[model samples]
Target chain A: MSAVALESVTVHAGGKSIVDGVSLSVQPGEWLSILGPNGAGKTTLLRVLAGTIGFRGEAALRGRRIRRLHRRDVARLVALVPQTPVVPHAMTVAEYVLLGRTPHLSLLAQEGEDDRTIAAAALARLDLEELSGRELGSLSGGELRRAVIARGLAQAAPILLLDEPTAALDIGHQQQVLELVDRLRREEGLTVVAAMHDLTLAAQYGDRIVLVDDGRIVAEGPPAEVLTAERLASLYGAQVRVLFDGTTPVVVPVRT
Target chain B: MTAAREHGLPAVSAPHVGVPWTLVALAVLAGAVLVGLLVGPVPIGIGPIAGSALAHVPFLDAGTQLEAAQEAIVWELRFPRVVLGALVGGMLALSGASYQGVFRNPLADPYLLGVAAGAGFGATLVIAYGPTGVDGFVLPLASFAGGVAAVAAAYLVGRSVGGGRTTATLILAGVTVAAFLTAAQTFVQQQNTESLNEVYTWLLGGLATSGWGDVLTVLPYVAISAAVLLVHRRTLDVLAVGDEEALALGLDVTRVRLLLVGAATLGTAAAVAVSGLIGFVGIVVPHLVRLLVSSSYRVILPLTVVVGAAFLVLADVLARSILSPAELPIGVVTAFVGAPFFALVLRTTRSSA
Candidate 1:
C-alpha cells in the first residue's frame, strides 16, 4: 500500500504558485529522493505533504486525506526534519529531541519513562549519547544536524521527510547519517522522502528520484534513467559530465 | 563512541533537580515574607506577629499578645500589602516567562505588547478628569480596560502586518502602540498638572495603600490565568523551537499563541490595575530562574512564582525602608537591581555563546 499520495496539489502565495499541481505516491518502506535546484519548491512540497501548509487538491497519508486527519494524528504518521531548524540556545540536546514525543502525549500529560527511553535510544543510535547533556549552543554544525535527525527518528513516525539532511556535514558524517537512516528504513520498514541537493548522494541512496524544477516535477524514474547529462544541463543550466561506473552514474561538473 | 563506551548511556533523563531547588525557593519565600511583615516604619516584633498569623490559621493557635496599634499595623496595613505585592509579582513574572517562551525571544516581557503604557494612560485619564470622589474600583477598572485594549490593538496590528508569523513584527507593533499611548498619557498629564503627582505615583508603581479589597479584586483573574499558563508549560517548550516545527509536532500553534497571549495579558492587566506598573519582576525573575534552575518551562514557570514573590517582597521592603518615612517607588528599586543583573546575564550568555 502507498504510504503517501498527492494528487493535483497546488499551493499559491503572493499571486504565484509556490507548488504547482503535482501528483506523486510513495509505497511503504520505499526511499524517494526529490532532487531540484534552489527555489524549486521542494521545501514547499514537503510542507504540503507534512500537512503544515494549505493546498488546493488532495494529499493523503496511509490512504486517508491529510485534511481529514487531526494535526496530532498526521504528526504521528509523518515527521519532517527541516533544512535549518531553529535551535534554542539554552536547550539541551536530550531536551530538544524529547519534544518528538509531543504527539503521543495528552494535552496536560508529561513525558514519561517510556518516552525518555525512546529518546535515549535515538540518541544512542545517532552516537549522540555523549553530547546529550551539552547545550545546543555548544554543538558544532555537524553535531547539530545529527541532533535534528535524531529528533526526527525519535518521533517514531512511519514516514520521514528530510529537507537537505546533510547540508552542513563533512563527507564522513554525511555517510554516517544517511547510512543510519537507510538502515532504519530497512530494519523498521520505514518509508522515507528526502529533499536533497547532492545528485550523487541522492542517486546512490534514493530507490527512485523525482526531479522538480519551477515547482513542477520534470522527470520521475530510476536514478540512472532520470539523471542524464542532457537533463542535468537543462535543469541546472550548467555543463556537467556524467560518468558511469557499472550501472551507477556519477555527475561531475565540467569546468570551462 | 569512546565517550559513550566509557560512561555508558549518558543520563538522558531531566535532572531530578527541580524538587530540591523548589524547596529552597519555598524557604527563601517564607523568610522574605517574614522579613516583609516585621520591618516597617512602625516596628513590629517578629514573635508576636508570627504568633498572631499562626493563630489566624484554622485549627492552629499560638499564645501571644501584642499592643492593639501594632496588631492593626501588621494585620491591616503590612500583611495585605505584602500579599498584594506577591500576587502582582508572581503574575508579572509568570506572564513574562510565558511571553518569552511563546515568542521564542528572551527579551519578551509581560508588557512587551504595551500593557504598561496602556495602563498608565488609563490611570492618567482617571486622575485628570474623573470626579473628585471616585469609587475605589474606578481606577483599577479603567487601568485594566486600557491594558487589555492596548494588547488587543497590538495583536491586531501584528496579525495584519505579517499574518502573525514573525515575532519581530509583533514586537514592532507593540512598540508602536506603546509610543502612541505614552504620548497620550504625557499630553493628559500636561493638561492637568494639578493631578500630575497622582499620575506620576501610579506610573512609578507602589503598594502603599493596598488592602484586602485590592487583593480580592485581582485574585480570580490571576488564579485562572496562572492555572492556564501552568498547564501549557510543555507546550511552551515545543514553541521554543519555532512555529513551523511546533506545528509539525502536532501542536495548534496559532491556538496556543492566542491562548498564551490572552492569559498572560489578562493576568498582567489585573496585576497592573491593582499595583500600578511594577517593572522588572516579569523580566528579571524568569531569567534568574532559568539561569539558576532549569530552562524547561515546567521548572521555570513554577519556580518563577516562588522566586518572583520572594524577590518582589524583598524589593518592596527596600522600597519602603530605604530612606525611612519617605518611600521610594517600587519600580525604582527593581530597576536599580534588575539592570545590573540583566547586564550580567547578557555578558555570561554572550561569552558562553
Candidate 2:
C-alpha cells in the first residue's frame, strides 16, 4: 500500500490557494524528494500528506483517508518532522524526544519504559545520547535538526516526512542527515519524503523526485529525466547545466 | 506510584530533588500551623491550645483561663484565617498555572484576563452600597459573575479581532478590559469618600474577615474548578506547542481554550470572592514550579498546588505576626516576596520572549 497518496488536493490560506490540484504518492521503503523554489507549495503539500491541514481533495495515508484516520493512528503510521519546530528553551533533549510518544499514550497516561527505550535508542542512533540531558536551546543549528529527527524516529513510525530538515545544516550535516534517512529507509522499510532545496542532494538520495513550481507540480520522474537543463532552468527560473555523473544528475548554475 | 502512563513507572527518580521539596513544604506547613494555633492577640502556646481543645473545652473545664484563651484564639481567631488563606492561595496558584499553560506566556498572571479588576468592581459596588443595597452572598456571587463575564468578554473581543491569528490580541483585549474595569472602580471609589476605605481594603486583599464558614464556603468551588483544569492539563500542553499542531494532535483547539480559560477564571474568581484580590500567588507559584520541574504540566500543576498552599500559609502567618496585635494584608506579604523571586527566575532562565 502507498504510505501516502494525495488526490487533486488544493490548500487555501488568506484567500489564496497555496497548493492547487496536486496529486502525489510515497510508497513503502521508498525515498521521495520534493523539490521546489520558495512559495511553491512544497510545505503545503507535505502538510496535506501529514494530515495537518484542510484541503479541497483527499490525502490518504496507508490506504486510508488522512482526515478519517485518528490522529494517534495516523501518527503511529507516519512521523512528520516540521520545519522550524520551536525548540523550547527549557526542554531537555530527552523530554523533547518524549513528546513523540504523545500519540501512543493513553489520554491520561504518561510515558512508560518502552517509550523511554525507544527515545533513548533514537538519540543513540542520531549521536545525541551524550546530549540527552542538555536543554534544546543550547544545541547548534545542525544538532537541533538532528534532535528533531531523532524525536520523529522515537515515534517509531514507518513513514517519515521531513520539511527541509537539512535547510539550516552545514553541507556535511546535510549529507549526514540525507544519508541517515536513506539508511533508515533501507533498513527499516521506512517511507521517507523530504522537501529539499538542493537538487544535487535530492538527486543523489531520492529514489524518485517531484518538482514543484509556483504551487503546482511541473515535472516528476527519475532525476536524469526531470533534471534536464531546460526543466531545471524553467523550474528554478535560472540558467543551469545538468551534467551526468555516470547517469546521476549534477546541477550547476550558469550566469549569462 | 502516580504516573499517567499505562504500565508506566510510578517511581521515576531524582527523589533526591523531589524529596527535599516535599520535606520543605511539610516543615513549613507544620511550623505555620503550630504558630497559627499558638500566637495571637491572646497568648496561647501549642501545649495550652492542644490541652484545651482536645481535653478541656468540651469536658466542662471550659471555665478555666487557659482553655478559654485556647478556645477564643485557636478555634475562633486563627484556625479559620489560616485555612482560608491556604484555600484562596492554592486556588490562585492553580489558576495561575492553568493560564500560563493556556496562554503559553510565563507573564500571564491570574489577573491577565481582567478577572481581578472586574471582580474588584463588583465587590466595590457591593461595599459602596452596604447592607441596605443588596442581600448577603450578593457580593461574592456578583463578583464571581463579573469575573466570568469579563473573561468571556475578553475572549469574545479577542476572537473577533484576530485571536485566531495570534495570542497577542487576547493579551491586548485583556489589558483593555482591565483598564476599563479599573477606571470604573476608580470612578466609583472617587465619587464616594466613605466607601474609599472599603474599596482599598478589598483591593489590598486579606484573610482578616475569614471564619470557618468562609473557608468551608470556597473549598468546593476551588476544588471543582481545579479538578476540571487538571483533567485538561495534557490539552493545555499541546496548546503551548501551537494551535495547528494541537489540532493535528486530535484536540479541538477552540473548545480546549475556552474550557481551560473558563475553568481558570472560575478558580481565580472564587479565590477573589473570599480573599479579596490577593496578588502574586497564581503567577509566581507556577513560574517557580516550572523552573524546578520538567516543563510537563502533569508535574507542574501538582507542584504548584502544594507549593501554593504552603506559600499562602507561610504568608498568612507572617501577616498575622509581623507587626503583631495588628495584622498586615496577605496581599502585601505575597507581593513583597513574589517580585524579587520573579527577578531571580528572569536571571536564571533565558526569557522566551
Per-candidate TM-scores read 0.94, 0.88
Candidate 2 is scored at a TM of 0.88
Clashes (candidate 2): 4
Kindly list the per-residue Cα lDDT of model 1 for residues B145-206, writing each as its tens digit: 78778988987998899897677788789888989999999999999999898778778888
What tens digits encode model 2's per-residue C-alpha lDDT throughout A149-249?
88788788888988997887888999998888888888888899889889998999898999998778998998888888887777678999888788899
Q: Which stretches of candidate 1 lie over 4 Å from their true place?
A: B1-10, B14-17, B58-61, B126-141, B155-172, B192-195, B346-353
Per-residue lDDT tens digits for candidate 2, residues B60-134, read 564433755456667767888778777787789988888878877676676767888878887788787767545
Model 2 error, position A2 (Å): 2.1
Clashes of 1: 0
lDDT of each candidate versus the true structure: 0.86, 0.77
